[model samples]
Target chain A: MEMFVHDETPTAAVDQREQVVSALAGSVRDLVDATIRSTVADEELLAVRAGVDALVARLRTEQRPGPAGVRYNSEGRSWSWGNAVVGHGNAIAPPLAIDHDTERGRSRAEVVLGAAYEGPPGMVHGGVSALLLDQIMGETASGFKRLTMTGTLTLRYRRPLPLGPVALECWIASEAGRKVTVEASIGNADGVAVEATGLFLVPRWAPLAADEQPEGWRRSAEG
Target chain B: MEMFVHDETPTAAVDQREQVVSALAGSVRDLVDATIRSTVADEELLAVRAGVDALVARLRTEQRPGPAGVRYNSEGRSWSWGNAVVGHGNAIAPPLAIDHDTERGRSRAEVVLGAAYEGPPGMVHGGVSALLLDQIMGETASGFKRLTMTGTLTLRYRRPLPLGPVALECWIASEAGRKVTVEASIGNADGVAVEATGLFLVPRWAPLAADEQPEGWRRSAEG
Candidate 1:
């Protein structure tokens, strides 16, 4: 069973669909933020709920039987629209745009968490910070050239991260055969908030020279 | 800087709003699932987007300036409607109905993992598991009697948890001074998939004898 599959969908078609679905996802993100902060009267909320249900029914008219797994075309273009962290169609995900410098084994993203991602008052949830670091560090280890699965993740809560703009960075600390050690952190101008050290492993079944087809393994930080 | 506050919203009013808002969140969750698997034409997607935008505008007519913070009433009814793990108003939060037995120092929740939470093909995202464990363990440590913040969390992924029904449980392993040690896990009939150990701390600023008013600190696993 190949971890990455060639689904035969052309890159252009995938891009077009992504644009439309991403626009919808963006609106849903706004809806979530608004919903969290809305103090409207019950009557207004009920009316809006009805409207949302109607939209949902309309969209359900056409559907796929299961989740959108990561897919790549024969031309080597890949996309993961259902990913928990970077899926374009996932409103739950903070809009994270990672910049991967494969040569330096580093990856970074800047995001502003809002109401939906809150844990404590005016602060980003510790778990949310872990979620972001895991995704970024996993990507850093994979480098889009090989498949990597998280083995162990350890986090230290150095300080509270406020609910606003924050930066995340991860780098390859070391590697031993199939095991890659990654160090990551999430913070803002004040310094690191949550620091993480993760061990990611390239499964034994993966091809040894998968790097020759790096594009096929790309997982949508650039999608 | 009190972590738990008596916001003065009447319990009855809070319950009524929770019912209405929870219904909306349920609908939104279904919408997310459908969106992920949808293979609809671009024209249809665009139309759905427009309908969604209108609904969002309707909801935004009257809104709070910021995120929803945890609040409680004089009657000691507490609600965290925006919590990432247990918020009734948060569509992104899985429907986690936690059963907390304070006397036993244990907390458990049963949830069904779905498409939107996917990471590896058909499997639950690693970070999502961490998020759930952190919340459940934190609640177990607090026992709704004292304020506890996550100090450190370490996770080991034993196996991939599939996207379906899963169970989570946490217990207070030990305690030393203001620090509490908690052990938690997420698994199914096959046994544990992920195991975690977390350190929870009662900040120096929190008053002692908080157990006198446990209800005042109760958060929304029971909302």
Candidate 2:
């Protein structure tokens, strides 16, 4: 009956299954990227299409009828792989992994932008940068305890971020009432290419965490 | 010597190929959604992976080593299928298509959100809504006559948008020198779910279009 104690499954077992599923999903994403850039002839393309469809049906021999909504167990392990940014099943997401330091309210991410994220020429899609920034910044603000929505975001693309590895770093700028401000930037070894500032706020609808709660917002360190 | 004459192919031919590629790519997108929700066992998943990879390889038998950049022809027809939002090859992109009306200085889009775009529970991802708005707003500002980049974007997530059909509309709010302000929103039959305002600017490195230019901004009706 306690908050966040819906299931008693050990975090280890949950994570192990998650790892297996994510790895498989990553490969599927790779296939998607390759399919988009291919210039093969129509006859071959149609054959491939039929094959892919059959394979998909095979994979879906058993399936979840609904989306994979967020879930957390008593062990404090939470997984939301359906997320657009970090869902292991998501090939559309950049190869991004962020290291969060709750002590300092800072987060850092390193990712490689490939052909899929390209917007103009070889540069990253401007919105991709925004998507990445909005996510990392929101994570830094929420720290997994409270759900925060991006209120407003301002981005300045000073220079093109090429289709390759990029670095992202951010920190909480300020907090007033329920509003948390975050500043972030993405770049390569050359330097920062895109800079961002965002305002994030906890919605009124969410029940505020009480002070008596034990470890209210701790994201599982393993993930 | 005329402007935007980089290719001599008939616009109709180019568009036909684009249509074909997009249709094939869309099927792959469906497969992607299926893969994420599949509950099949490891043996079946592995077999599916191999089959999908082989299909991808067949499609990529011919390829372009570089990103697909925007191309315009003498007839004022342009295509930028690699664009992050409108890219036909980009399965990660929201199925978004914007119809820009240069005469009215407005842009409209109709889309259907699916499993891939969820952020909170069954609602559309906030970032996805922001991404859609950014692209449509940019197009409204440029009118397909010049290059523009998002300088800053402000979004307010009014309410959760469920996974389903939605509508987007935008118009140029104002233009001052190289800066253009655009207002936009996304909604469904229920009502508007997200609202946005963005500032778009011509990069300093880009040469400004001459004042005497004839038919300064022309968007092809076909997208």
Best by DockQ: 1
What value does the lDDT take at residue A148 in candidate 2?
Answer: 69
Runs off by more than 4 Å, candidate 1? A1-5, A211-217, A220-223, B1-5, B212-216, B220-223
Could you list the CA RMSD of all candidates, in the order they appear?
2.6, 4.1
Report, for every candidate in turn, its global Cα lDDT versus the true structure.
Answer: 0.80, 0.71
Residue ranges of candidate 2 with Cα displaced over 4 Å: A1-10, A205-223, B1-9, B204-223
**DockQ computed for model 2 against the true two-chain complex using alpha carbons:** 0.45
Candidate 1, position A101, lDDT: 100
Worst 10 residues of 2 chain B by lDDT: B214-223
Task: Tell me the tens digit of each residue's lDDT in model 2 across B1-223.
Answer: 1122266668898788777777767877777787667878767776777777677677667876766655667776766566668887677766577787977889999988776775565667677777788778877887766567777778776776877899999998998888888899998999998888888887675544635233312321111
Q: Each candidate's TM vs. the true structure? A: 0.94, 0.88
B1-223, model 1: which lDDT tens digit per residue?
2255567778898899999888877877777777787777888878888887887888788886776777888886778888877888877788577899999999899999888887776778888888888888888888877778888999998888888899998999999888999999999888999999999887886744555545555662221
Maximum-lDDT candidate: 1
Fnat per model, in the order shown: 0.62, 0.52
After aligning candidate 2 to the native by TM-score, how far in Å is the CA of A107 from where it should be? 0.1
